[model samples]
Target: MARITMKFGGTSVGSPEAIAQVADIVKHTVDERHEVLVVCSAMSGVTNLLTEGALTAAAGNPTRYQAIATHLREKHSNAIRQLLPSDVERISIRDEVDSLIDEFETLCYGIYVLREASHRVMDKVTSLGERMAMPIISAALRHNGVSSTTISASYLIVTDDQFQNAGVLFDDTERRIRRELVPVLAQRIVPVVTGFLGATRDGVITTLGRGGSDYSAAILGAYVDSDEVWIWTDVDGVMTTDPRVAPDAQVLPVLSYGEVAEMAYFGAKVLHPKTVQPLVDRNIPIRVKNTFNPSFDGTLLTHEEHVTPSTVKAVTAIRDVSMITVAGRGMVGVPGIAARTFAAVAKQNANVLMISQSSSEQSICFIVPEEKSASVVESVQDELAHEYGRQDIQRTWADDDVEIVTVVGAGMRATPGVAARVFGALKEASVNVLAIAHGASDYSLSIVVRAADTERAVQSIHRLVVLNGISPNVHAPEPIKNAVS
Candidate 1:
């Protein structure tokens, strides 16, 4: 029998109908003689509501949290009623759900009384969404005639004390899974596990960050030594680019681990940033499928990606980003400026997206989320205050009206002239490139451009590299007349 771990995002089980559909998927997997371990996120929007409640209570408005609690209670109550078949199951599930809700409410009340919500308390509060979801999903599976038990990942997956974004402790987690969960799976019982949550060794609640549900699934799949891990989300599979930005974007049938990693780093919505590491370590293939369209095989990711005729597999963009440039003629051979510049950014916890430096070492530039740019600039200026006063450092400034566009394909590593073709496409489309960075692996290249030119740039790149392949001795069609203007 095949041992497989299947994970569903919130949208997959957003409502009664959706939960019913998920139960059907589980039933079908079991009937095929596969050992299925399920991981699920909270119902759609539930976690946000829980987070808002915690923040509101922390803002000295505990009464507002009560209204949120009531709404959440009603939401889960309705889901349980729609999913469970008999009154016996309904009553049992209701009691468990209500108890968990009470725990959530109590946490909010504590935050209100203290007028503060630490990351630790927020972790405990936010985790209640997944805790509340597992019971309904487990009961739904049983109603479908599948013997399933709701298992708390907090008991199986062990992590460090990082409350809001904990890192999984692999050795301890693997050992705990073997001791606590293997026996249950061996009994032919499916374990419906909560996703996005784990606990410290001392049993303090913690999360793996947003979209950690996928990370949870990857972890469990590796622990079980499963043959494959499938992530069921709303989209059919990983797309060449976000369709919203490029209408011509197409779904990639397969990808390499590296290719998807680049996409994830540049803000692809398909997988969590940390989701692929565990499975990659175990050499397990991950399949991205759509719960809404189960008939499609979706996309598969493995070490050896499918070799496409095209050198570029996908073009994706990250919007609402700012580019920060640090330039100084006097610091051309500076030893500590780069280190000091990044140190300031690190203090703000800002993520650097794409980085480019002048060969002369006279200037350095990188992209970060627009929201964090102001703080990042302030910190850098403070760090280099003396240099600025002496005019040794020319300027450190941020441009908030920019985006990062990346083109990814494992084929690009082995192909020649891929970068030429990418730039040619952009040039033809009249999209001004502010900066460019080619990854060391050669699997991907990124360009920073004005936000207004993003869609045009992505569409043009997709049409040239993806659709036409830009074969040797052939060039993409000439740029549309003033298309980017």
Candidate 2:
């Protein structure tokens, strides 16, 4: 029997009803004779409440934070009362929930007094969500006649003290899981741990960033060397495009690691970017399943065992981006010009998304999220205005809504004309292609398109590259004139 690790997201265990649904899924897995380990996120919207509490406390009042904490405590206790049968189980679950709330209040009090929320303290506060949710889930599973134990992830998943975005120490984490967690699995008992929160060497709470629950599952799956890691989420699986944006978007049955990585980086909402690394390193396949539809065969992500399909595997895009241009004749052969421009952006904490440099070294262009566009432009102007002069180093910021559309497929590398086919389809659809970028891997082709045409662009690319077997050399019609300007 294959030993597997299954993780359910917040929506999967949002309430007593949802918890029962998850318990049913677990029962099926256990009945199949596979040793199972399950990890669960907080109830739907619980983490957000905890975050709001911290923000309120940091803004100078602890009253609202304390009230929110109490509300959260009541929410979990209510779930336990509805789900657990034995009085002992109910008390044990309540006490664990209370301890988590106590920790949260302690952190809020610190934030109120200091009038600040450091990443370390934020991690601690955010962790309470999972800590409060997992015990209720474990108790529910036990009441359902499945032997389950609540294991604290902070005790097993050890990382360096990087606070909000702590990096995992794999050797230490793997050792702890093998030595400490394996014993429980050996007894055929399911270990239900809280996802998204880990601890530093000194036992201080640290998080793995916003979508850390996905990362938590990947880490545990790798440590145990499980046969497969199943990520239970709200979506059906990884789709060819965002269903909301492109109604024609279809779900892909299989994907390679490279394809999945590209889709995640370019804004596929199925899984976090970091969640695939451990699976890739350990050669474990990952399945993205829907919590609501447990019977469907969801998408499977595996290493390249065979060539990717010739058609485009998926289309991904993200909106609300601003493109910045740094161009000047003086930039030609100017050493440290690129370095200075990037350093300036970094100083303002603006994330550089896509960067393209001209072969002549005369211009460097990058895209940043719309919110940081102004700050980034000012930082660049201040840093480069003197060296190349205002005119010499021309700076222009385009507020024209832009969307990044990427076509992902491992088959593109072997197929000649994949890029030509994608561009050809977009051209046929009259979708204006701005800057285009492709790497040596040939797994993806990214293009800048107008936000208005984002959905059409993805649908067109999906049809041309994925559904219809069109050749890259297929001739595309002439470009459409810009009427919006």
Name the top lDDT candidate: 1
Query: Candidate 2 on 12-126: residue-level lDDT in tens?
Result: 9998888998888887777777778898898999989988988899999879998998788888888888898789979988998899898889889989999998887788888
Model 1 TM-score? 0.94
Q: For model 1, how does the per-residue alpha-carbon lDDT over 287-381 read when each residue is reduced to its tens digit?
A: 88889887677788888865566778888889888999999898887689999999999999999988899999888999988999999999999
Model 1 CA RMSD to the hidden true structure, in angstroms: 6.6
Off by over 4 Å in 2: 305-310, 396-400, 469-485
Error of 2 at 89 (Å): 1.7
lDDT of each: 0.86, 0.81
Give me candidate 2's TM-score against the actual structure.
0.91
Give the Å error, residue 204, model 2: 0.8
- lDDT score of residue 456 within candidate 2: 84
